[model samples]
Every structure is written in structure tokens, then in C-alpha cells.
Target chain A: MVIVVATMPIWLPATNFLTLTDGVLAGIYTLLGLSLVLLIGYTGQLALTVNVTYGLGAYTTAILTVDDKLNPWLTILIGVAINVAFALVLALPLLRLQGHFLAVATLGVALIGFTVFQAAPITGGPNGIDGVTPLSIGSLQISSDTAFAYLAWIVALLALIGCRNLISGRLGRAMQAIKGSEAAASSVGIRPFRVKMMVFVLAAVLSSVAGSLYATYTGFVSPDAFSVSFTITILVMVVVGGLRSVWGVPFGVFAILALNAALQTYGPSLIPAGGTDIPIVGYGVVLIVFLMFLPGGLASAAQRLWRSATGSGGPRRSMPEIGGAVSEESS
Target chain B: MTFLFAGLTVGAINALTGLGLLIVYNVTGVINFAQGDFVMLGAMAAILFAGANGHRAGLPLIVAVVLAVMCVSALGGILERTVLHPRRKSGPVLLLIMTVGISLVLEGVVLVITSSQSYGLRNFTPGPALSVFGGTVSLQSLWVFGVTGAALVALYLFFSRTRVGKAFRACEINPLAASLVGIRPSRYWTYAFALAAGLSALAGAVIAPVTTATYDMGLALTLSGFVAWVLGGLVSPVGVVVGGVGLGVAQGMVNGYLPLGLVAYANAFPFVILIAVLVVRPNGIIRSLAERRV
Candidate 1:
């Protein structure tokens, strides 16, 4: 799959499928999805503010690059820093709330973030920032859709590897333990609040990176680009993609993106009005319907298929995980 | 004075929306994100039946209002049965996400129906605005307050006096025990959702004139309602009423005080108070009389 994605620019000219832009987005979305899974699936945060973090990242990149003339690469670090600060401020109040309370508070913060993005002068208000500095490594400017796709995937892959390690490491276990039972986790000497805060910050940073990359690729950042609905869409994508395998996220991202693309391509023609909003209903329904059939998400279904395919599995993975996240999470 | 009246008016509507969330949560432990969508539907439905919003139904105002409420309530019941109840066994997180789906579907359908046009509903009783405390309150504001008060009174009576309402409380206490007592919790679940929907719809019908009905209004109202519910401590009716009113008043103050340059952010004012409350009093300002679910 990596090879196919890596070599896609070579063979893609021969085919009629125009997914090069979606490829870039899917890569970025994979990072966003992974970050979400780390927060909700693994860390038990159930956050609805991923969009804000992503938007903050994009805005940070946009502001720094456009106003300060800072290198786009530098803005990635700046974006991460901003997201951490934002997350820290939000998590301080949020840590006190749990379940629906946490979710609602985060949703509120996200709304506030959206308002700020739309109204604040720094963010260019509702118009957003245009003429964003494109990402480049030295003189080798990362221009063209194909190079951008590679840049996104490489970052996504690196983030995926980092998250995979985090999931298996001591801190990751601590996060999982907290998710299961904070009381039990703390009894074993884990500070639940501290761990939860760390995970939240980490997720924010990841979202920020994805958002920054997205801004650079698009060469624009606006309040219109970041919305609560997009946050929900990301949540749906991660959930419907499946929660069991961190590796399955990209596949889920692509599938959901494809579903969206198909809807966009055909929705307006079939429907009389509201073509732009049709994809959301389709995805929302897909999330609900997918949960009905595959509660663990498509990754779980994939694991099942792999199990039936492999036949001999004792502590062995049903499928290959992206960046070597295989076996441990499997049954 | 205007701020106070505005707060009271929107406060009443927020209270209704919060009640919708509260009732459904009490019965089913699910936060219906679609509650605001129901309110939007009710307002739109009322407009449609009243021959407003380019609709030619031309029904009488009273009949149109009744039909709107009834239709929305029925739709709520149908939604609970088909979309929510089937997924009752799933985790709360999944169910919450499902309500989001329901909301999106509703909003999408409405957007398609209205082509994204905003529609105004004629005031229930056309009258001169009342001057009180050096400010004039629209008649619709009176209707909002009146309907809310009557709804609360009716709810109090229903819960205290009606068999089904008691059974709903019973179901809230213990679904297993309620089922054992031949009080079908499933059936009551439908009723609770329908009741919540009816309450929200009624709020929409009254405030339709003040705010107008739009396809996208439901999502923001849902958050405001949730904030009101959370401020009231998620479990208690009294808490939500107070919380809703408090939030509304707070919002009124923010809108009153904030500079015109910053007024665009006033939509986030209630949430600010909500988060502050969550930080200071995590259990909510109005703690339950008895121990409740955290």
C-alpha cells in the first residue's frame, strides 16, 4: 500500500481517477484521525475540539508565514507550541469535567475558537489569510500536487510511528489504564489528570501539524475552513474507520473521503438544492449505520477478515499495521 | 432593561431547549444533540402550516401551531424508536454520536426544503409592546414566558400527578425495576423523547417570530441548550431551569456590555459561563437534592 501510494504519481497519469488532491487531504486527515484516536479511543478524552487545534495550527502557520515572514517549517513548531498552549488552557478547566461534561465543554471551547477565528484581526477574520508561504526544504520548493502528497504522507507516517510507539510504551499503558479505570490507574501510581493532560496536549500538537500542512498546501487559511462540523466529520471518520487498529485510520480516511467525493460529484446533480451540505448527511448516516454493523469500526471488520484469512493466529496479528503497530492490539 | 427582556425571552427558549435535553437524559441517559433540530422543525412546521415561508397551507394560527407541535412530537417519538432505541445497548458515546447524525439529517433535509432561506412566523398575538422598567418587551416575549411557565407547570403536574410521568420517573430510577412493574421502559422512552420534542417545539412556535426559523439555527441552539443543561447539572429539572435562566441572563449581560466591535463573539458568551461553572463547581451550581449520577 505504501509503495502504491509512493509510486502513484508515476502511474497516476495513465489512469482517469483524479484523487491526487484527495490523496494529499487524506494523508493530512490520517494525521488528524490518528490524533483523534489517541485522544478519544486510547486516552478516553472524547474531545470535540480537534477542529480548533487543527484550525489553530493552520492559523498559526498562516499568520507566522504571512505576517512575520517566518519559514513555513518554523511555523510547524510555532503551530505546535500554540496548540499546546491552547490545549493547556482548555484542559485546566476541562479536566474537572468527565464524560458528557468534558465533551460539552470542549464543544463550547471549539465554538469559541471558531468565533475567534472568524472575528479576530490576527486570523484575518471571516475572510481568513491568503498567499500563505508554501512549505519548502531549502531551495527544493515542495510545489505541485504530487510532491505535496509525499510531504503530507511522510509527516503522517512519522506521526503514525510516534503514536504507535506511544500506544505501546509505559505512558501509553498508563493512558489506557486511565481510560479503563482512573481509580485503578492511580492506585498503581499513575496521575490520571497529568496523563490525560499530556495526551490532550499531544493530540492538539498532532492536529496542529495536520492543520499547518493543510494551510501550506492550500496556500490559504480561513474561519470557513475550520468549523465544528468539520470536527464532527473528523470524529465520524475516525470512528467509522475503526478504532481497534491505529493503522486502519488511513484506510478509513480514504474510504470516508471517497464517500464524500462521490457524494459531492453526484449529490448536486441528483438533488435539487443544498449540494454542498449533502456529503455531511451521507457521512453522518454512514457513521450511525457503520456503528450498527461494526461497532469497533472498519478496522475491526478488517481484523475479522484477516483472522479468517490467516487461520493460524495465536498472539499474531490478523493484518499488517501501518508503521509496525501489529499484534499487540490484536486478539 | 432591553437586555433583561432579551435575556428573559431567549432564556425562556433556552430553558425549553434545555428541558428537552433534560427529559431525554433522565429517561434514557442519552444527550440528544438533535434537540435543537426538533425546535427548528417545530418552528418551520408551524410556519409551513400557517401559510408562511411561501407555504400555501393557509391553516388557522391555532391549528397550525397545534399541528406543528403534534407533528414534531410524533417525529421525535418515531426517531427515538427507529434511530435511538435500536442502539440503546451501545455505549453512551455511540448513542451521542448517533443523535449528531440525526441532527445532520434533519438540518440537511430542512436546508433542502427551505433552500437555505430564513422565514419569519407572525406573532401569536399581535399587540403593542409592553413598557416595563424603561424598556419595551415584545408581545412574543410574553408568549415565550407564558408558554414556558405553563409548560413547566404542566410538566410539574404531569410528573407529580400523571401515571405515565410517574412511570417515567420510575423508569429513570431503575429501568429493570420499571420493567418488572409492567411499566414498559421502552414505551416510556418513546414518550420521554416525544415530550422533550414537544416542549422544544412549543418553544420554537412561540419564539418563531422573534428569531425567525432557519435551517442552520438548530446546531447553535443545541450547544446553548446543552450548556444550560450542564449548568443545571445534567440530572435535575430545577437545576436546568435555573441554569437556563442564569445562562440567558448572563448572555444578556454580555450582549449588553460587550462593545459593538466584539458583539460577533457574543454567541459564545453562555458557553464561557458554562465552562467557568464547570471549572469552579464541577458538579454544577444547583446540586441535586439527592445523590445523582456523576
Candidate 2:
């Protein structure tokens, strides 16, 4: 499945379906979804700051490459480092918060990040910076649509492999233990704070890397691209794909983006009133429906369907319960 | 002095929005992310009903205001009954995301209907500005403050003296116990949503004259109101009011003293303060009685 998706640019356009640009977007969103899975799914931290981190990475790469004349590849590293630093600083105060409080705090930080992006003159004040150079090695530039698609997919694949390795190691067990019960994890010699901080930084770095690639690919960075809606879309993708599965990231990103594209392409023809707004409306409806009926998301649904079809299920795989009751007392 | 009055007016609006959030949260244990949209709905509905800004079929201002509030309240009731009530057993994260979806849909609908245009409502009573403490205050600002005060007083009375209000309080205290005493939590949930919607709409209507109304205004208002709610610890009404007003004043001061460049980022002040407060006192400035015992 990974090989098929990674090599999609080779054959996707011949079918006259999704373009190379869509592939690039799918790659970016998949990176974001995977990063979110690391934090929200694995560590049980409800964070909404992914978009801001993505913005930071984009802006960093855009400004560095455009103004400071730095190498695009080097800028990506710098952006990731800066994002990890920011995440650590943010996590210091934020790690203490739990549940809705943590979610709200991260949201506040994202909102603040957005306001700064809009207000800061260095960010070009909402118009955003342009003339972002594409990624290159020596004199060979990866600027074309097809080339950027390959670059994005290659990086996405590496990130996926790295994340899968991390999840299969001791860190993954620590994350699952912490997510299950922070108290129990700590009592059993796991440092919840350290594990949570590591996962948070890792997620931020991954998101920043995706953001840097996005800027490099598009050659422009705008405030509108990093809005709360973008964050919400990535979140929907993570939840819709299946939170606990690494393979769910690509599935979620591809499904939602395809749905959006299909709605945009065919919706207006089907309904006279349908226009650009149809995709947004479609997204809203799909998110709500999935949340209501398929809480474990499409990945789990697919697994269940496959098992039932083969009639080989001795016992059903239960969904990972994410609803840990944490302090319901109103204060 | 001018900043103080400006802060007071905005603070009153924030307080009302926070109160709306507090009410729903106390009853349902879920934060209504769409609270600010209710404010937007109130303002937009009033504008449309009053035939303001090229709108047809003008109604009397009082009648328009009442109709707008009622419409928004009914929307809140309908939303609670349909989308949320069926999924009440879902986790907090799912419920929160559901509210976000609801907010997106509400904003989308308003955007389509209003054509993404901003609208303004006429002040309650247009008149000359009054000079006080070396600062001129608009009559509209005074009206905003007056309405906020009256609403707060009325809300207090409703919560303390009325039977339905006591039922709301009972649900907040203990939903199971409240149900045993013949108070249905679901009924109060719907009521709390409507009440909060009405209050937020009222706030939006009053503030519309000053800030104007736009479909996209909900998120900012929600964030600011949420900041106030967090600062107040999400429980006490009086604390919410104080936090709201204090936040408004701090924002006013930032705008007054900061550089032009910094002033452009003044909207983030409450959020920054919210983070700081949460870090220092996760329970907020006013701790609940149960928390104090620990």
C-alpha cells in the first residue's frame, strides 16, 4: 500500500484524476496527520497548535530563503529547530493542563501565533512573503510539479518510517502507558513529563518539516493558508483516518482531500446552488457524520469490514478508548 | 478615562458572553464553541429584521430585537436537541469537535446568507456624547453598560428565585440528584443552551452598534470570551464578570500605550493572559469549594 501510494505520481495523471499538486497536498496533510497522531493518539495530549507550527515553519523557510539568501534545505532544518524550541517553551506551561484546558491553551497559542503572523511586518503583514526558492542540491532544482510531488512523497515516506520505528520501540510503549494512566505510568518508573515533552517536540518538528516543504513547493506563504480552518481540517483527517494506526494517516488525508476535490469538481454540476462553498459544507457534514457513527474513524471501519468479509475473526479488535475521565468537578 | 469607558463597554459585552458560556458549561459539562456565533446571529438577525443596511421589510427596533433573540434561542434549542443530545455519551474530545463542526456550519450558513458583508445596527438612543472625567463617552456605550447590568441582574434573579432557574442550578450541582428530584438534565441542557444563546445574542445586538457585525466575528469573540471564562475559573458568575471586565481594561491599556505595530496585535492580549493564568493557577483565580479543601 505504501509503495503504491508513494509511486502514484507515475500513474495518477494517466487516469485523468487527481493532479500532481493534489498529491503534494496529500503528502503535506499526511505528515500533519501523522504528527497529530503522535501527540493526540499516542500520548493522549489534545493539542490544536499544529497549524501554528506549520505556519512558523513556512514563514521561517520563506523569510530565510527569500531575504537571507539561505539554502532552502538548510532553512528547513532551521525551521524545524526553531519549532522544536518553541514547542518546548510552550510545553513548559502547557504540560500542566489536562483535557479541555490543555486543548484551549494550545488553541490560544495558535490564535496568538496567527495574530502575530498577520501583524508582523517581517511576515509581509497578511499578504505573506513571495519568491520562496524551491529545494535544490548544488545546481539541480526540484521546482516542477512532478518533481515537487516526488520530493514531498519521499520526505513523507521517511517520516512515516521514522514514526513507525519510534512507535514500535520503547518510546511507543511509554506513550501508550502514559496515555492509559499518567499516574500508573509514573508509578511504574516512566517519567510522564519527559515522555510527553519528547512527543510534543517530535510532533511539532514533524509539522514544521511539512510546513517548510509546503512553502518550498508553493513558493509562497500566506496567513490564510495557516488559519484555524486548516488546523481543523488536519484534525478531522487524523480523527477520520483512525487515531491509533500509522497507516491511517495517508488513508485519512487521501479520503478527505479526494472528497473535497470531488465535491468541488462535481458538486456545482449536480446542484445549481453548489459552488466553492460546497466543499466546506461537505467537510462539515462528513466530520459530524463520522464523529457520530464512526468514532474510531475509517481505518477501524475498514478493518472491521475486512475481518467480517473474510469470516476469520475469532475475536473483534476493540477500539482504543480515548475517553479518560479526568476531573469532571466544576470549579 | 476614555480607555476606561471603552474598556467598560467592551468588558460588559465580554462578561455577557462569558456568562453564556458558564451557564451551558455548568449544566452540560461541555464548552459551546459556537457561543460567539450566537452573538453574531443576534446582530445579523436584528440587522435583517430592522431592515438596516438595505434590508427590506423593516420592523420596529424593539420588535426586531425580540424576534432576533427568539430566533437565535430557538436555534440553540434545536441544535442541542438534534446534534448534541444524541451524542451526549461521546467523549469530551468528540463533543468538542462536534461543537466546532456546528460552528463551522453556522458560520458557513451565515456567510452564504449575508454574502460575507458586515452590517451595523442603530444605537438604542442616538444622542450627544457625555463628558465625564475629562473624557467623552458615547450614549451607545452607556446603553451597552446599562443593558449588561440589567441582564446580569435579571440572570441573578432567574438563577436564585425562579423554579426553572433553580432546576438549572440543581442540574449543575448534581445531574443524577437533580433527576431524582424530578428535574430532567436533558431539559435543563436545552434550556441552558437557549438561555446562553439569548444572552450572547443580546450582547451581540448591543455591541453591534459599536463594532458592527460580520460572519467571521464569532471566532474572535469566542476566543476573547473563552479567555475571560478561563480567567474566572469557569464556575463563578461574578468572577466571570470581573475577569471579562479586567480583560477588557487590559486590552484597552495595551492599545492605548503600545506602539502602532504592537497595537495591531492587541487582540492576542487576552489569550496570552489566559495562558499565563492557566499556567500559574490551572483552576483559575477563583477556585471551587471542593478545590479549596485540597
Candidate 3:
């Protein structure tokens, strides 16, 4: 499946379906969605700052390459480091908050990032920093849309593998334990805070990587791309695709981006003038419907159908226990 | 002195919004992320009913404001009944995300309806600025402070003096116990949602003249209100009011003294203060109810 997706740019256009650019976007969304899966699905932490971290990476690469004359590739590492450091700083205070409190706090962090992006002269303000230098190794440049699509998918695949490996290990168990019950996990020597912090940083790092790739591919970095709405869009993808499944990340990402792309192409004609907002309404409806009817998302729904077909009986593991109610649980 | 007045006005708005959040949170155990959107709805609806930009057949300002409040309250009630009430058993995270979805939908609907144009309400009272302590303050600002104070007093009386208020408090204290006592938690939850929406609309209508109304304003207001709630420790109503005022003043100071380039970052001051408070006093300046458990 990964190979087929990676090679989609070569054949997708033959059927006039999706393009290399669409593939690039899907790859970016996959990275972003997987990051959310790490925190929301595995650690049971609700964060709205993924886009802020993504912006950090994009801006880091954009500023370093444009203003400091640094290599694009080197800027990626620096961006990731900065994002991890920022995440650590943020998580130290934020991890103490539970449930909706944490979500709102993260939203505050994202808003602050946005304000800085728009205000700081170094960030180029709302005009944004364009003419971003693309990634190059020696004389070989990954500037073309096709090449960038391949590059993004390759990185995305690597991230998926890394996430899967992380989730299957002792660290993953610690995350699950913390998600299940922090006090119980602590009693068993799981160090919930440390584990949660690690997962938070890992998610931030992934987001930063995706952000850097996005800037490199588009040759532009704008604050608009990292707004709170963008964070919500990524969230919609993660929840719609399925929260716990690594394989579902691509599907979710593709589903949302394809819908958005389709909407952009056909929405205006269908909705008439000044009704471009119909797609946004569609996104909200999709999110609400999915949460209400399919809490575990499409992946879980698929699993349930498969189980029924195979003559499996007993209770299904459709809904994972909600993790953000730690405070209520303690009470 | 100017900063003080500015801060007071902003703080009053924040406090009102925060109180709305606390009211719903206390009863439902769910944070309505749509709280700020209620403010937006109130302001926008008022603008539409009152009409703007040479549009005639506009209702009187008071009537428009009342109708807007009622409309937004109905929205809150409908949202509670249709979307949230059924999922009362879900976790806080899911509920919070659902509110976010609702907010998105509201924003989109408002954007479509208003065509994304901003609207301003006529000030409740038309008067000249009064000079005090080397600062000139508008009569509208005075009205804002007065209205906020009155609302707080009314809310206090409602909670402490009324049976329904006591029932609401009971629901917050322990839903199970409240249910056992024949107090239906769902009824209070619905009331809380409506009350919260009405309160937020009041704030929105009051502040609309100063801040103007836009479809996108809710998210920012919500964040600011949340910061104020955190700063107050999410406990005492008075504490949140103070927190909101302090935050507003601090932002005003930052705007006044900070360099032009840094002025944009003033919006982030509430967040920074929130983080600092969380680190130093995780429970806030006033101890939270959860902390009082001991």
C-alpha cells in the first residue's frame, strides 16, 4: 500500500484522479495526522498546538534559508530541535492540566504562535517569507513537484514505520498505561509524566519535520498555513481516518485532502456565489457525525464489519476508553 | 490611567465570558468551546436585526439586542439537545472536541450569512468621554463596567438565593447525589447551557461597540476567556473577574510600553501569564474546587 501510494504520481494522472501535488499534500497530512495519533490516540492527551509546531519548522527553515543563507536540509534538523525544545517547555506546564483545560491551553499556545508569526519582523509578518530554498543534495535538487512528492512520501513512510515501532514497544505500553490510568500506571512504576512528555515531544518533532518538508516543497511559508483552523483540519483527518491504526493515517489524510480538493474544484459551482464556506460546514458535519456514530473512526468500523463477516461473536473493541477524564476518574 | 480604563473594559468582557464557561462547566462537566461563538452570535445577530450601512426597516436597538440574545440562547439549547445531551456519557475530551465542531459549524454559518463582513453595534448610551486621572474614558466603557458588575451581582444572587440556582449548584457538587435527590441533572445542564449562552450574548452585545463583531472573533475571545479562567484558578467568580481585569491591564501595559514590533505579541500576554500561573500555582490564585477536596 505504501509503495502504491508512493508511486501514485506516476499513474494517478493517467486516470485523471489525483496529481503529484495532491500526493504531496496527502503525505504532509499523513505526517500531521500521525503526530495527532501519537498524542491523542496513544497518550490520551488532547493538544491543539500541532500546527504551531509545524509553523515553527516551516518558519525555522524559511528564515534560516532565506535570511541566514543556510542549507534547507540543515534547517530541517534545527527546526526539529527547536520544536522539540519548545514542546518540552510547553509540556512542562501544560502536562499538569487535564482534559479540556489542556486542550484550551494548547489552543492558547497555538494562538500565541500565530500572533508572533504575524507580528515579528523576523517572521516577515502576514506577507510571509516566500522564495524559500528547496532541499538539495550536491547538484541534485528535489524542487520539482514530482520529486518533492516522492520525497515527502518517503519521509512520511519512514515516520509511519517509526511510529508503529514506537507503539509496539515498551514505551508504547507505558503510554497505554498512562492513557488508561495515570495513578495506576504510576503505582506500577510507569512514570506517567515522563512518558507523556516524551510522546508530546515525539509528536512535535514529527509535526516539525512535516512543516519543514511543506515549506521546502511549496517554496513559501505563511502564518495562514499554521492557523488554528489548520490544526482542526488535521484533527478532523485523524479522527475521521481512525485514531489508533497506523495504517489508517494515510487513508484519513487522503480522504480529507481529496474532499477539500474536490470541494475547492467543484464547491463554488454547486453552492453558487459566496457559498464557498459550504465545505467548511461539511467538515464540521463530518467531524460531528464521525464522533457521534463512529467514535473509533473508519478503521474501527471496518474492523467491526470484518469481525461480523468472519462469524466472530462477543463484544467488539470498537470504542477505546476515553482518556482525558483523568480528573473525573480520580474524583 | 488610560491603560487602566482599557483593561477594565476588556476585563469585564473576559470575566463575563469566563463566568459563562464556569456555569456550563460546573453543571455539565463539559467545557463549551462554543461559548465565545455565542458572543459572536449575539453581536452579529444584533447587527443584522438592527441593520447596518443604510439598510432600513431596522428594529430598535434594545429590541434587536433582546431578539439576538434569545436567538443565541435558542442555539445553545438546540445544540445541547441535539448534539451534546445524547453523548453525556462520553469522556471530557470527546465532548470538548464536539464543542469545537459546533463552534466550527457556527463560524461557517455566520460567515456565510454575514458574507464575512464585520458589524458594529451602536453604543447603548451616546455620551462624551469623561476625563479622570489623566485619562479620558468613554461613557460606553462605563456602561460596560456597570453592566458587568450588575450581571455579576445578579448571578451571585441567583446562585445563592434561588432554588433553581441551588439545584444547579447541587448538580455541580455531585450529579449522582443531585439525581438521587430528585434533581434532574439534564434539566440543569440545559438551563446552564442557555444561561451561559445568554450571559455570553450580553457580553458580546455590550462589547460589540468597542471590539466590533466578526465571524472569526469567537476563537480569540474563547482563548482569552480561557486564560482568564485559568488565571483565576477556575474557582471563584470574583477571582476570574480579577484575573480577567488583570490580564486586560497587563496587555494594555504591554501595548503601551512595548516596541511597535512587539505590540502584536501583546495578544500572547494572557497565554504567557496563564503558563506562568500554571507553573507556579497549578490550581490558580484561588484554589480550585478539585483542590478543595482535601
Candidate 4:
């Protein structure tokens, strides 16, 4: 799968389907989606900071490169560190909240981040900073769309493998245990707060990486680009693709992005002009449909099919529970 | 002083939104994110029926308000029955996400209907701004206060004096035990949602004259209302009312006193309060919800 995605630019014609820019966006959004999966899917902390950290990364890159003329590569490291610090500080108060309270508190965090992006002078005060310097090696300039596409995908795939490995070991078990029940996990000697905080910060770092790449690739950073709507869009992507499946996260992102692009191309004709909300409605309906019908998402469906094909029909595994009211179980 | 009055008016509306949130949350344990959109829908529908700016001949103000409130209440019940009923067994997190989905759909449908146009409503009662306590208060602000105060009293009475309301409290305590006593929590879910929708619709209708009806306003309203709800500690109805008023007054002061160049940051005030309160006291300013229940 990695090989197919990485080498697609060589063979696939840009004339018809996804262009280089869209693929680059996919790579960036893939990181954000994976962060969501790790935090919400694996850890069960409904802290919505994907777009916040992503914005931090974009702003960090945009500010450093445009204002201070710092090296773009160096800014990415600084952006990740900043996002990590932010996540650590926020997770302290947020991890104490349970279920719905935690979710809304995260929303509050998202809104505050948005305000700072729009109001702060350093962010150019809603006009946003433009004229970002492009990234380059000692000799190789990453100015072309195709080169950035490779750079983004290579980094994305590496992160993907890193996340896959990180969540598959003892730490992964601890996370799943916390997701199931904090009391039980604590009884077993896993500090729920530490585990949750670790995953949250890690997710923020991943999102920061995406944000940095996005700013340099787009060559501009704006508050409009980091609206709360995008955060929900990413949530829908993570949920629709597969919540717990690491490899399945991109499938959700690409599928929804393709759907959205298709809508933009064809929606005006079918729905009439000024029907921009059609795509939004599409996202919301897609989220509800996938959650109700296939909560495990495409990955679990594929896993079930694969097992049936192999003639060893495994007993159905229960859906991984998140932090919320266990109304049915408690009752 | 004028800023204080303005804050109180906005606070009343925020309280109404928070009240709507508390109703559904207390009865069903689901935070209906669509509550603000309900307020938005009511305002938009009323604007459409009563005619924007009172230039176009349309339904009378009373009739228009009733129609909008009734329609939104019905829609809320229908949504609860159709979209949320099947997911009743699902965990609360999924239910919360589902409300978010519902919010998106409502906002989108509203955007389609309104064509992203802002509608201004003529005040429900025709009058000049009244001078009270050295501050000029608009007549519409009085209407907003009247409506919110009436709602608070009615709800207090309903919860304390009516069997149905106590049944709601009963379910809040333990739905299973309530069910054992032949009280169906599922039935209350739809009713609570409908009631919440109606309450917010009334709030939006009354407040629309001051804040024009717009498609994108729902998100702000949701943010403000949620902040108020959290400030009340998510436990007490009366606490939520006080929470909403305090938040409103604080926001008003922030807006009034900020330098001309920095007033734009006041929009972020509620969010800052929300994060601060969530970090400092997730419960609320009032420590014990049990002692202060409506």
C-alpha cells in the first residue's frame, strides 16, 4: 500500500483524478486523522486539538519563515516542540474531565486557538501571513508540487509505521485498558493520567508535523484554513474510515476528500447554486450512517472478510469502547 | 450601566439556551449540540414567517412566533425518534457525535433555506428605549427578560409541582430504577428534546430583534450556551441560570471596556472562561449541585 501511494505520481495521470496538491493535502490530513485515531480511538480521550496543533504548526512555520527568515526545516522541529508543550499543558486539566465534559472542553480549546489565530498580531491579524519560503536541502529545492508530494508522503508513511509500532506494544495494551475502564487500568498498575497524557501529546506532535508541511506546501497560512469545521471534518474522516485501525485511517481521509471534490465538481449542477452546504450535509450524513451501520469502519469489515476467506472464523470482537457513559453496562 | 443591561439581556438568552441543554442532559444524559441550532432555526423560521425587517407583509408576530416554535419542537421530537432512537443503546460519546451531526445538518439546511442572508426582526412590541437605573434599556430587552423569567418560573414549578417533571428527575437519578417503576426513560427522551427545542425557539425569537438572524450564528450561540452550561457545573438548573447571567455580564463588561482596537478579542471571552473554569472547577462556582437543585 505504501509503495502504491508513494509511486502513484509517476504513473497516474494528473489530467483526470487527484492532482499533486490534493494528494499533498491527503498526506497532511492523514497525519491529523491518525492523531485522532490514537487519541479518541485508542486512548478514549475526546480532546479535539488536531486542527489546533495543525494551526500551531502552520503558524509557527509561517511566522518563522516570513517574519524571522528562519530555515523552514528548523521551524518544523520548533513547531512540533511547541505543539507538544501545548498538548501537555492542556491534557493536565482535560484528562480529569470525563466523557461529554471533556469533549466540550476540547471544543473550548479549539475555539480559543481559533481566536488567537485570528486576533493575534503575529498571525497578521486575520489577513494571515503570506510569501512563505519554500523548503530546500543543501542543493535540492522542494519547490515543485511533485517533490513536496514525495516529501509529504515519505514523512507520512514513516509516521504511519511509527504509530503502528507505538500502539502495538505494551503501551498500546495500556491505552486500550484505559479506554475500557480507568479504574481497572489503574488497579492493574497503569497510571491512566500518564498514559492518556502521553498519547495526547504524541498526537499533537503528529498534527504539528502535518501543519508544518501544509504551510510550506501551500506557501500561505490563514485562520480560515484552521476553522472548527475542519476539525469536525477530520473527526468524520477518522470515524468513517475505521476508528481503531491504523492503516484504515487514510482510507477514510481519501474517500471523504474524493467525495468532497466530486461534490464540488458536480454539486452545483445538481443542487443549484448557493448550495454549498450540500457537502457539509454529505459529511454529517456519512458520519451518522457509518456509525450506525458499520461502527468498526472499513478496516473491521475487511478483517471480517479476510477471516472468513481464511476458513478460520474468529468470534466477533467487541467494538473498542471510548470514555463516555457506559449506560448499558452500568445499568 | 448600559453595557450591564445589554449583558443581562444576552445573559437571559444564554440562560434559555443553557436551560434547553440542561433539560435534555438531565433527562437523557445526552448533550444536545443542536440546542443552539434549534434557537437558530426558530429565529430563522420566525423571520421567514413574520417577514424580515417588517417590510414584507406576513404573519402577525404572535402567530409567527407560535408557528416557528411549534415547528422546531416537532422537528426536535422527530429527530430524537428517528436519528437517536436506534442509537439509544450506544454509548454517550457516539450520541454526542450524533448530535454534532444533527447540528451540521440543521445548519446546512438552514443555510440552504436562508441563502446565507441575515434577517432583522421588528421588536415583538413597539416601544422606545426605556431609561431605567441611569441606563437606557431597549423595549425588546424587556421582552427577552420577561420571556426568560417566565420560562424559569414555569420550569421551576413544573419540576417541583408536576408528577411528569419529578419523573424526569427520577430518570435522571437512575433510568433503570425509573423504568422499574413503569416510567419509560425512552419516552421522556423525546419529550425532553422537544421541550428543549421549544424553549430555545422562544429564546431565539425574543432575542432575534437585538441580534439579527444569521446562518452562522448557531455556532457562537452553542459555544456561549455550552460555556454557561459548564459554568453551572452541569448539575443544577438554577445554577445554570445564574451561570448564564454571570457569563453574560462578564462578556458585556469585556466588550464594553476593551480598547477600540482590541474589542475583536472579546468574541474569544467565553472560550477563555470555558477553558479556565474547566481547568479550575469542572463542577462550577457553586460546589454542591445536590444542595441547589431546582
Best-performing candidate as measured by TM-score: 4
Q: How far out, in Å, is residue B62 in model 1?
A: 1.4
What TM-score would you report for chain A in candidate 1? 0.91
Per-candidate interface DockQ score: 0.47, 0.45, 0.49, 0.57
Q: After superposition, how far is residue B261 of candidate 1 from its true place, in Å?
A: 3.1
Choose the strongest candidate by DockQ. Answer: 4
Docking verdict class for candidate 3: acceptable
Per-candidate Cα RMSD to the true structure, in Å, reads 3.4, 3.1, 3.0, 2.4
Using all chains and alpha carbons, the TM-scores for the candidates as numbered come to 0.94, 0.94, 0.94, 0.96
Candidate 4 has an interface RMSD (Å) of 2.8
Off by over 4 Å in 4: A10-17, A318-331, B287-294
Going through the candidates in order, the fraction of native interface contacts each one reproduces equals 0.48, 0.43, 0.51, 0.56
Q: Which candidate wins on lDDT?
A: 4
lDDT of 3 by residue, A1-331 (tens): 7669666877767746567787888888899899898898878789889889999999999999999889999999999999999999888889988766788778878888888888888889999999999998789998888888888888888998998888888998898788778999999999998999999999999999999999999999888999889999999898888877676788888777777767777877886654667667778877888777777777776777777798876564333432122223221
Error of 1 at A29 (Å): 1.0
lDDT of 4 by residue, B110-165 (tens): 77667788889999888889999999999999999998998899998898899998
Q: Which is the better candidate, 2 or 3, if ranked by lDDT?
A: 2
Q: Write the per-residue lDDT of candidate 2 for residues A1-331, one digit (tens) a residue.
A: 5677667878667656678788888888888998888887777788899989999999999999999999999999999999999999998889878877888888889888888989888999879999998998788899988788878888888888888888888999899888777988999999999999999999999899999999999999999999888898898787778777677788888888888878778877875454566666666777777777776677777777877898876645343422212111112
- What fraction of the native interface does candidate 3 get right in terms of contacts? 0.51
Query: What local distance difference test score does each model get?
Result: 0.83, 0.83, 0.83, 0.85
Clashes of each: 0, 0, 0, 0
